[model samples]
Target: MSRIEKFCAAFPDGDAERIEEMLHGYLWDSISVRDTAVRKNMKEKFYHGMVLGLLQSRSDWLVRSNAETGEGYSDILVYMPDKTGIVIELKYADDGNLQ
Candidate 1:
């Protein structure tokens, strides 16, 4: 079975804590801080690609990057088959130019 199918099956009642833990673990285990800074100037696109690659592994989830909303673009958008969608925003923590 696909990863998404297995995930849904494992959490038949949609356990939010388990799902969050799984995602957190995946981010910690699969992505490396060193691997994220391969170039001199890392842009949001780079981070987006990293996250997109991870989400794409789930055969049942549809992932979109920089999707336009009514106000602005969302950094990452995840659509589940039978549940609410997920919207993710990426920002530089040290950047002081946020509005």
Candidate 2:
């Protein structure tokens, strides 16, 4: 089986919460060297694109970037194979303020 097939087989329900947990853990462990801050020059769009690619690669799911919603535009929208959708909003904080 392929990587996507394996992931789908492992998570048949396309559990957004579980995927979120894993993704969060991945970002937490993969990055962050100074308490809660990351290296300089890495902006919001960079992380946003990275996450978009990661999600697509991991699950091969249909993901839309900067999707329009009733309220406003969202940073990311993911369509799961189980006929569910996940919306994500992204934010950025420069070196000056992240509070």
For candidate 2, the per-residue lDDT at 91 reads: 64
Tell me the number of clashing residue pairs for each predicted model.
0, 0
Which stretches in model 1 have alpha-carbon errors above 4 Å?
Answer: 1-41, 94-99
TM-score of every model versus the real structure = 0.54, 0.53
The C-alpha lDDT values of all candidates are 0.65, 0.66
* Model 2 lDDT at residue 73: 92
Per residue, candidate 1 scores C-alpha lDDT tens digits across 1-99 of 765444444333456666556655666767677665755346556656865776677678788888999899898887878875877676543364657
Model 2: per-residue Cα lDDT over 1-99, one tens digit each? 754344333444657566556656666766665434545545677678866776677445788899889978999998877787777776665654647
**Candidate 1, residue 47: CA error in Å?**
1.5
Candidate 1, after superposition: displacement of residue 70 in Å? 0.8
TM-score, cand. 2 vs. native? 0.53
Give the Cα error of residue 57 in candidate 2, in Å: 0.9
